[model samples]
Target: MANGLDFFSIGGADAHDGARAVHAWHVIRWLLCGWSLLVIPAFYGELTSTSQGALTIARSLYLCMFAGFALCLLWMLHTSRKPKAWLAHNRLDVTIMIGAAFSAGWGAPPWQTVEWVLRLLFVGLVAIRIVLSLKVFFAPNRLIGLLIAGAGVLAMAGAGFLWLEPRVHNYADGLWLAFESSATVGYGDIAPTTPASRVFAVFVVLLGYGMLSLVFASIAAAFIGKEERALRHEMHRDIKHLNAEIVQLRAELHALRESLTPSSDAITDAEALHSVPRDHH
Candidate 1:
C-alpha cells in the first residue's frame, strides 16, 4: 500500500487550465468505476441465463472497458516527467493489468474455471482501483466498509463452492464451513475432504486474513486520527483564548499604571503656582 502522504505529492501542471483539465480527466476516469461496478454484477447475473452469444458480447464489452482504463493509466505513466512518482502512483494498477493478462493467457484447468477467474480479476481490480482513485472522497470508515463488503463477496464464493461440492451436506453447512475456514477459527466440525475443497479453503483463509487486517487497521487509524485532530484543534483554541486574555490583562495593567501616575498637566500647574508664590514672598 502506498503511504497516504504520497498521494499529495502529485502536484498540478503549470498551465492555468492544466489543473482543470486533469480534474475533468479524473472525473471521466471515475466514471469507469460506476461502469465496472454495474456491468460486472450484471455480467455475473446474466452468466447462467444468457446464451453463449450474449455472454461473449458482454465479455467483449467488459474487455473493451478494461482496456480503455488500462490505456488511460498507461498514458498517464508515460507522460509523467517524474518516473518514480508515476511508478509509485500506478504500480498497483500495472500489477492488476499484468495479473489479468497472465490469468487470461496462461491459466490452466477448464475453460469455465478460467473464465470465472477472469471475472473475479475484473471485479476485484476495478473495485480496488475505484477505492484508491476516490480515496479522498471516501472516509476511512467507508473504506473499511468496502473491505468488509469484499470479504463478504469472498465468503459468498466460498459458500457457493462448498455447497456445490458433493461432499458438503447442505447450504447451511457450506456457509458455516466457509465462515469458519475464512476466519481461521478451524472449528474442524466441517472439513474439506477433497483436494479441490482444501485448495478453496486456502484461498478463503488468505483473503479472509487480508481483509480482516485491512479493516481493523483502517478503523483504528481513522478513530485515532480523528481524536488527534480534535485534540489539536481544542489546544489551538485554548491557546488563542489564553493569548487574548493575556493581551486584555496587559491593556488593563497599562490603564491602571497610567491612572496611578501623577498627571503631567497637574504637576506643571502646581510648579507654576509655587513659582508665583515665591515672587510674592
Candidate 2:
C-alpha cells in the first residue's frame, strides 16, 4: 500500500521548495484579487463627465488590471501541479473576462449601459468566486475578519449610494441605511426618497442578496469540504495500518509454517528406516 500510494508527501527539501512556491502563488493571487476590487470604484468614478484623456486612462487601467488577473489565472492553470483544482478555482474569473470582452464590443459608448452591466457581472462573479475558491478569505477561525470585510464592502456601497442619493445626510447615516437595506431591516427612519436612490437601492438589494447567498453557500461548502478531506485522510491512515498489520501477520504465518514443517534430513532418515532390504532380513 505504501508503494501504491502516490499522493504528495510532506518531507525533505523538495517539500519545503513546494511550500514556498505555493506561498508565492497565494500572494500573487491575493494581490490580483485586491487589484480587481478597485475596478468597481474606478468604473463608477468614470461615470462623471471627466476629461476624455482621464476616461481613456481609467478604462485602460481597468482593462489592464482585469487582463493581468486573467493572465495570472491562465498561468496558474498552465503551471499548476494540480491543473484540475486550479481550473475549478479560477474558471469563473476567466469566464467573466471573456463575457466582458464580448460585451465591450457590442455598441457605441462602450462604457455606458453595457459597461454598467459588465461591471455588475464582474462584481457578482468575483464575489461568488471569492466565496467559493478562497477559503482563506472567509476562514471560520477568523470570524472577525469576515465581519470586517463585509462591513468594508457595506461601507463602500453606502458611500457610493450616498453620492447618488440626495437624502442621506452623512456617511454614517448612509452606512446605516445600507446595512438596514441589506439586512432587510428597512427601518422607517431612513429610506431612499429620490429616484436615483431608489434605483441604487434596487441594485443594492439584489447585490446584497446575491452576496449573502454566496457567503452562506461558501461556508457550507468549506465545512463539508473540510469534513470530506478529514474523512479521506483518516481512511488512508486506517488503510495503511491495516495493510501493515496484514503484512506482519503474513510474515508471522510464514515463520510458523516453517517451524511446523519436518526437517529434510529427518524426512530422509524416516524414509530409509521404513525401507526394508529385499528378502535379506
Candidate 3:
C-alpha cells in the first residue's frame, strides 16, 4: 500500500518525521559508503604490514569505522517511530555489523587460517553492504553508473588479489585472474594456489556473476525499452491519423447534408409561394 514517495522515504507518514529520517538516512548511507571504501586500505595495511605499529594503526582505523557505522545505525533506529520494526527491516545490516565487530575483536595470528577466515567474512559482509546500498539508493536507470562502480570494484578486487595471491606477480596478472575468475573463464594461465587466494577467488566469482548479470540485464532492458518506445510512437501516430480522418469525415458529412437538404431560407420562400391564395385556387 506504500506509495513510491513513502517507500523511498524513511519516515512513514509525518512530514517532520520524514525530514529527520531523510537526513539520518543520508548520513548513514554516506557513512556506510565511506567505511566500505576505507576497508580496502585498512585491510591491506593489516595484511601487508611488517611492523607491529602499522598493524595496530590499521586495526584501530577499522575499529573506528565499525564504531561509526554502529552509531549511524543507532541514529537511524532512534529516528524511527518503531525501533523494533526498523531493526526487523534491517536484520541483515544489524547481523553483519555484529559479526564484523566480533570478527574484528577476536585476535588471531595475522594472515593465519583463522585470521584469513575472519578477513574473508568481513570483506564479504562489506561487499554485500555495498551491493545492498546500491540497490536501495540507485534506480535501474542508473545502470551505467552502476557499471562504472562495478568496474572500480573489480579493479580493487584485482589489487586485492595482487596482494593476497602469491602467484600474482603484477597488477595485470591479478586483474587478469580476477576477470577470468569473475567471468568463470579460468584461462589456466594463472590460478589461485593458496587457501586465501582460493577463498578470495570464490568472492570474486560471486561478485563477477552478479555484475555480469546486471550488465546483460541492462543491455536487454535497453533493447526492450527501445522497442517499446517505437511501438508507442507508432500507436500514437496511428491514433492521431485516425482522429484527423474522423474529423474530416464529420466535416464532409455535414457538407453533404447541406447539399442534400433544403436551406431554411429556401424553405421559407417555398412556404410563402404555397401560401399565395390565387396560386392555391
Candidate 4:
C-alpha cells in the first residue's frame, strides 16, 4: 500500500538489520502456520465427540493461532513508517484476513445454516489476496472464478437442502426454497408457499444476483493506464540506474589494474627483454 516512507531511512538506524529482524519474526510466524496445519485437523475432528470442556480447549487453541497471526501484522505496522492513508488501506486487508481466520477457527451457528456465510467470506479473502498479489488483468477477464464459484455454491446449498430436508422437515426446506426462488425457478415438489419462506426467497434473489454482478460484471473494463504504467516505467528507471552503476564499477576496476601495473624502470632489464619487443625495435 504506498510502501510506507522507507521507515528505516527516517529512523537513522541500520535498515538491513531491521529488515533481518522482520525476517526472523516472519520465520516464527510461519512456524506457527506449520503448527496450525498440523493440529487444526485434529481439533476439527474432535468437534463432534468432544464435550464443552474439550470444545473450550479446541477453541482456545484456534483463537491463539489467529491472535499470533494478528501479532505479526501489528509488528509489520510498527516497522512501517507510512502515512495514515497507507496504513488505513493496508489494515483493512490485515483485519479481514485475521477476522476470517478467527471465524474459521471458532465462530458458528448450526454450521449447516451459517456455513455458507463462512465459506463465502473465507473464499472472498482468498480472492482478494490473489488479486492483490497478481495485480494483473486476466481481463476483458477481470475475474470469473469467484463468481462462478459463488453461484455454484449457492446452487449446491439449494440442492443439498432439497435432498436432506424431508427427513427432519424443518429449516432445511426453507433454505432450499430460498435459493430455488432466488434463481427464479422453483419446483412444486418442494413448496415454500409460506410468507416467511417467500420473504427469504426475495432476499436471496436480491443478494445472489447483486453479489454475482459485483464480482464478474467488470471483466471487460480492465485497462492498465497511467498510474500502473508509471509503476512499470519506474521499474525500467531502476534497471537503467543499476546498469550505470555496473559500468562505473567496471571502469573503477580497470583503473585499479592500471594503477597496479609496473613502470618501465620497475621491470627488470632481463624480464623486459624477454617480453615481446616493439615493432620499431
lDDT of each: 0.59, 0.63, 0.73, 0.51
Candidate 4 lDDT over 1-281, as tens digits, reads 34654321112112344664446445544443343342323234233323666556655655665666567556655664542433454454454446546654664423564764654454344334433332333233445755665556576546534433443265456565656655667676575443323333444565566555645455433354455778899999999999999999999999999899987777887587889667874
- Looking at model 3, residue 19 earns an lDDT score of 71
Candidate 1: global Cα-lDDT?
0.59
Evaluated with lDDT, which candidate comes out highest? 3
Q: Which whole-number lDDT from 0 to 100 does residue 270 have in model 3?
A: 97
Per-residue C-alpha lDDT of model 2 across residues 166-193, encoded as one tens digit per residue: 6787888889889877777888788887
Which stretches in model 2 have alpha-carbon errors above 4 Å?
A: 1-24, 49-54, 81-89, 99-119, 133-135, 139-143, 188-281
Ordered by lDDT, highest first, the candidates read: 3, 2, 1, 4
TM-score of every candidate = 0.53, 0.52, 0.71, 0.32
Top-TM-score candidate index: 3
Q: Which pairs of residues collide in candidate 3?
A: none
Candidate 3 lDDT (Cα, 0 to 1)? 0.73
Model 3 agreement with the true structure over 29-52: per-residue lDDT tens digits:
767667666666666666667788
**Model 4 segments more than 4 A misplaced:** 1-65, 83-87, 90-147, 155-178, 181-207, 214-281
